[model samples]
Target chain A: MNSRREFLKLAMAGSTAAVAAPAAASAQAKPKRWGMLVDLRKCIGCQACTVACTIENDVPEGQHRTAVPVYELDGPNGPSQAVLPRLCNHCDEPPCIPVCPVNATFKTEEGAVVVDAEQCVACGYCVQACPYEARFINHKTGVADKCTFCVHRTSVGLLPACVETCVGNARVFGDLNDPESEIRKLMAQHETKGLRPEFKTGPNVYYIGLDDRLASTVAVGGGARDLRQGLETSAHGEV
Target chain B: MPAVDLMSFDHEAVWRPWAVAYFLLVGTGAGAALLLAYARLVRIAEAKGALIVAASFALASGLPLLADLHQPARFMHFYLGSAPGSIMWWGSWFLPLFIVSTLLLAFMTGRRGNAPMCGGERMLTMIVGALALCILGYTAGEMSVVAARPVWNTLGFPVVLILTALMSGAGATMIIDSLNGEKGEGRYMLVVTGAATLVAFGLWMLTDTNLSTLAADYAPVGLFGGFIIAGVVVPVVLAVSAKASLLLRGVSGALAVFGALAFRWSTFNGAQLMSKTETAFYGHEAALSQDALRTLAGSAGLLILSLIFVTLLINLLAVRASKQTQA
Candidate 1:
């Protein structure tokens, strides 16, 4: 009984140390939960973000890192164009991370999901796993590529290329963990919605004034999509 | 009434026909390994043909898979680390081990010169059989875990893959038996498996709303019909009727093998063609580029060569057995 008490005391001490150590470390700096907030009502469908993102990431022609899909929908007034800017959600419970065969894709320390290109086998498993249709196998490099949430600029205390170029100030990005962050403020004020929330992916990217049909799936292919596809195929047949 | 898409890029399928070929060939190989285990257990003389199909197809199955990978050279990354959460990572480990154990079983003869089975050979067969089951499970889990692809996400997808693998492997073994003039036990197994696959798929359609909806909307009449009739029904009919000529046997065998290929093409590749955001499919562009052709050629050639080598080995073993009996 004496020996059992001694063992229990040792176990209790170890558990306390384990709990206290992380708390002490966290005092220095708590890890940031990065997030994006898109205010759809503010967007003008300029395609500036698309063009800027392409230039910033050096994305190939006919492929997208991020693209604004404009849908023609009938509202309370009449038919008007509505835009849903699509990009990698970089979800808290990212489906893409766990599906990677080689453990090449992972969430960074600050909570942005990124792929290690050098280590990637480019099997396209993650590409298929993504519900957002955000990831693609880079035709030039033959590796999985997606929006990194502009980690390059964000880390250096600069806005993402897309955010910087948005004429309407639609794309608001910041650390969700920070109470004073612009994104947190907007999210507090507005009823923000995430795309494909039915999948329960816990998307870090949230939106305001999102249409119900646009959030789920859009009925397409009887309009400009067919013509665009045809022309792209025929025009860029060699590539 | 409908939302018209003014501008959207065409999304190409992440996995192409190369993926379909890999799945079909690998699934067939795993099933053949299972058949080999059963044959060895029952003291069947036709184990070598099953063994050959199992090892050769498993051996050659990696190429198309590598081709499917855009960076085939980086395949070593699969082994450098381990990720338990990933079905694909689990598959990477299961695949190599399965191949090695199968090859070991093939090299160590089961019944030599009509002798009773040796002890080690029996143990190895069981191991190979167990590993074969792992490979089947791994392959099914790898695809079925994709919640994004509604057709593949169903429980029935794995069942159909497994059942089809069993019958297709049986078909392959039967083909070899007919070529060597041996009465194949696979003929009977095929009828059972073919029927099981049909029932499983029918139940799948009824129970799973996602699959039922997808099938209603876009299941191709030609490819899907070909899989049901030519692959399952025709082959099942031929196998049940006894006293079939060698020509018919070979034809059915070929059809069965091709049927497995057709099923993967129509389902695995077909599922990728469907759009998640848009109602209509992102139409298939069937690329016959130099890269695709080269990859297919390389993998198919390896498969052919392995088959030839196994055939010669079988013939040599027969001659040696005859000499021993004469002595």
Candidate 2:
């Protein structure tokens, strides 16, 4: 039993090491981590970012290009809450990338999960593999899609749509590698959290002001109500 | 329903529909395959007819999955690899196997004096039967892996899917055989009904004990009301009362088809309803989010065109082949 336990631990550690080794080696070579930080305290859930994302990417109607999870928390006095905007956590160990049957979806050098629309066959395999429900098949393009952190914009040194149009200046986009970058600085100063850290997807998107209950709920079952809705609608009507 | 902000991410809602479609397609295909295998095993005269139906259903079920894809053309990539770790990945590998097995079974039985090589055929049927069970088991495992959907994350799902596949497939075969003027598929019917009852019972037990089991439970209502009563129960009762009545057999068979289809549809819909209701408090829209709707429309259009083309091609080929055979 002791030997078996030891073997299991070694196997687990070996696999973990194998997955992390690539990211760690890549991080060392680049010495820069690409990430997004959202300040929940400042966000008003105006949804400008969502709109901008759809417009910029020409995302189809009915499928979300990005999703901002809104939480109505019980405040100190009355029922007050905050909206926690989420997209592809763009995990350091992205569950969606390697599971792609055709390598249509992949991670870029800058650590963003990118989908080549042309290469995508619209199989929902990656969508299912994703723990965050971040990936969706874009109807028009016939490709799996999620927040790329606006790879197209970022290439030209522009901020992501969510970050660019934040009325409350809640969302921040920057290289996590640079110590002086806004996102890096925020991480250093604040006690921010990622959604479902226990799953260890190593999400790059970090959040501030996420309640413990909400986080735990997401972590344990990955948005159960949302899963239920998708299943119900697809049965009676067209998916 | 109020239009919740489309941008809000509710994980359950987003994943639910895709899962339902996946489950339905997998269930339908496996069920059809198993029925075909059972028909072959029992040496049913119209076993070839059942095989054709199974293959056609399996092929048809691939349609919804295309719509589910973000890039429908890229679906071939799944076939390019041999990834054993993923149920979806491995499930895909079974498609061609099923196709080949069905084609072989059809070819062997379609002609009057040419049955599948006796011993070889039996072995093939057994192999395909085992594979069909594997596919069904994988379908259940696929859902169970979600972990987040407490109802889906269990062992009962795999068993239910396997048994449901057998019941549905056997039920379909009995009906088709009766339609083709073959009688006395009673033993197969009994086996199917027995299997279905056990599966239904297991499903009920799971739902009764677990609050999280709502996702699967909602399906049986449709199954019993739409399929079981209309398709299996009434006909089965009639057939039981009167032996060797082609009329009774035909009715039961028809009911079985209806029940199987209804079961697939309900199971797909019920899971989605559970996910939607459970997550409504999160403020995400229950309707198709913008991106998903557009994808669906695009996939639908493509699938419609493809089906038209495929049907025309198949019809033309069939005409030519029949003429050659006659000559």
Residue by residue across A51-78, what tens digits does model 1's lDDT show?
Answer: 9999999999988889998889988899
Off by over 4 Å in 1: A1-28, A229-239, B43-45, B110-113, B209-219, B287-297, B317-327
* lDDT (Cα, 0-100) at B99 in candidate 2: 54
Top of the candidates by TM-score? 1
lDDT by residue (B85-172, candidate 2, tens digit) is 6677776777667656755544444332332347766676677677777777666776667543444556654555555555555555
What TM-score does each model's chain B reach against the true chain B? 0.90, 0.68
Interface RMSD of each: 4.8, 7.9
A48-74 per-residue lDDT for model 2 (tens digits): 888888888888775666756554445
TM-score of 1: 0.89
Q: How many clashing pairs in candidate 2?
A: 43
Q: Give the TM-scores of the predictions, in the order they appear.
A: 0.89, 0.71
Model 1, position A156, has a per-residue lDDT of: 70
Instruction: Report the C-alpha displacement of residue B327, candidate 1, in angstroms.
Output: 7.4
